[model samples]
Target: MTTLTVFYIGLFYIAAIIFFGGLAYRIYEYSRTPAPLNIPTTPAPTTAGGVVVRMAREVVLFESLFKSNKWIWVFGWLFHVGMAVVLLRHFRYFQEPVWFWVEFIQPYGKYASFAMVAGLAGLWARRFMVDRVRYISTPSDHLMLALLLGIALSGMMMTFVAHTDIVALKAFALGLLTFDWHPLPADPVLLAHLTLVAVLMIIFPVSKLLHAPGIFFSPSRNQVDNPRDRRHIAPWAQALERDNA
Candidate 1:
């Protein structure tokens, strides 16, 4: 048990360091890379309302996914919603006796976990079954999906099928948060589930799953389409321009 605990703790730190270090390097490289010399020649919105509508549709409704393909949009939507619910359910882990609301939502949480696992599986299948998705899919993309599916499946199993000592798990979690190591008697299934979850967290900042944050960095989403008419500049960009000038 001690050896396994040490191994997983070591794996967690190694993965976290590599993932964060790689992400920082990637961002630095991207920052140094020159922007496209050619301006985008896509048709511009003709009216203010049109521009507002376009931005609203893309940001709120994921219009780009719909435009890409309706099925893609549907799968993406389901996967995102399921993920959100599952994340909310995880708050139970930090609380004692769980909260009333969490207890109230326990049934839905189970359903949400099941839905998330199914959604990830469906998305993975869609990636292969659809030609467009298949054409664009990379191994890393598939791995990310597979990892999420594995984590969700393992977590659901822990919640519903496998009996876990929640008290022990909670004690270990609190100990870790307090920077004290209190190793619990190791359950292999719980350990595996936790290891997978830790792996996901470590990889998240580096993966395309980073689009969770990367959406804010997207020029199309973050930058005004009418940059010519409006002097729109990111604060950091403006600072750089001032320093250079």
Candidate 2:
């Protein structure tokens, strides 16, 4: 293997490890954190089943975001859905025989890049255009958007402009899965795309992007509105009560 191939291979391995390991650790921390109050938002679910449905709506439809701000929700939903389709499309590169649905979405995913970029651009613009949003926005927030925009733009360039050797790229992706090394395509666009993806993965656990998982642990979202029906005792509180008894 050439030095370039070795460098990319090592870079990806390190990136994958950091991404998965850090995310897992962060999720574990989230699970262990205490929710001491029944703080579900108004008009929230009262039962576990209702909570599930509510969470589904929040996750898939961005229900809370939709209710809070329609414009932001529109852009956020477009970016999320488009990014999901693009990710699903990438399964073809890793699987030897891609699933039927994955094969079918190729055309949609090819064009979804446009939606992704447009949504990102709108969201980024909001940081500058909206006074309240701009006041609260940090440099890291802007950097994250820039990183995602870079990844999406580079990928579109590879797909619609300067095409790379996708076959070799697929081989490289599969090889990463099986420990069998393959030479990574050294196309500048491809390299830029992959590097940005790796960077995103590595920083995801520490970044604001962690809201993806953190939402599930949110007391305001996940809790049932039943503090009056049944006492809302945290696990630690329960243990203290037991010791007192």
Best by lDDT: 2
Every candidate's lDDT: 0.70, 0.92
Clashing pairs in 2: none
Model 2, span 46-132: residue lDDT tens = 899999999999999998899899889989999999999998889899998899999999999999988899899999999999999
Error of 1 at 174 (Å): 1.4
**Tens digits of lDDT, candidate 1, 1-245:** 49776676567567767777766766666566544332322464645566666666765678778888786677777777777777877777667677888777767777887667766777899888989879999998898887888887878777888878887777776655565656665887788788788788787766776666455345454333465666545567778889999
**Cα TM-score per model:** 0.73, 0.96
Residue 141 of candidate 2: its Cα lDDT?
A: 91
Candidate 1 steric clashes: 0
Candidate 2 worst ten-residue window by lDDT: 33-42
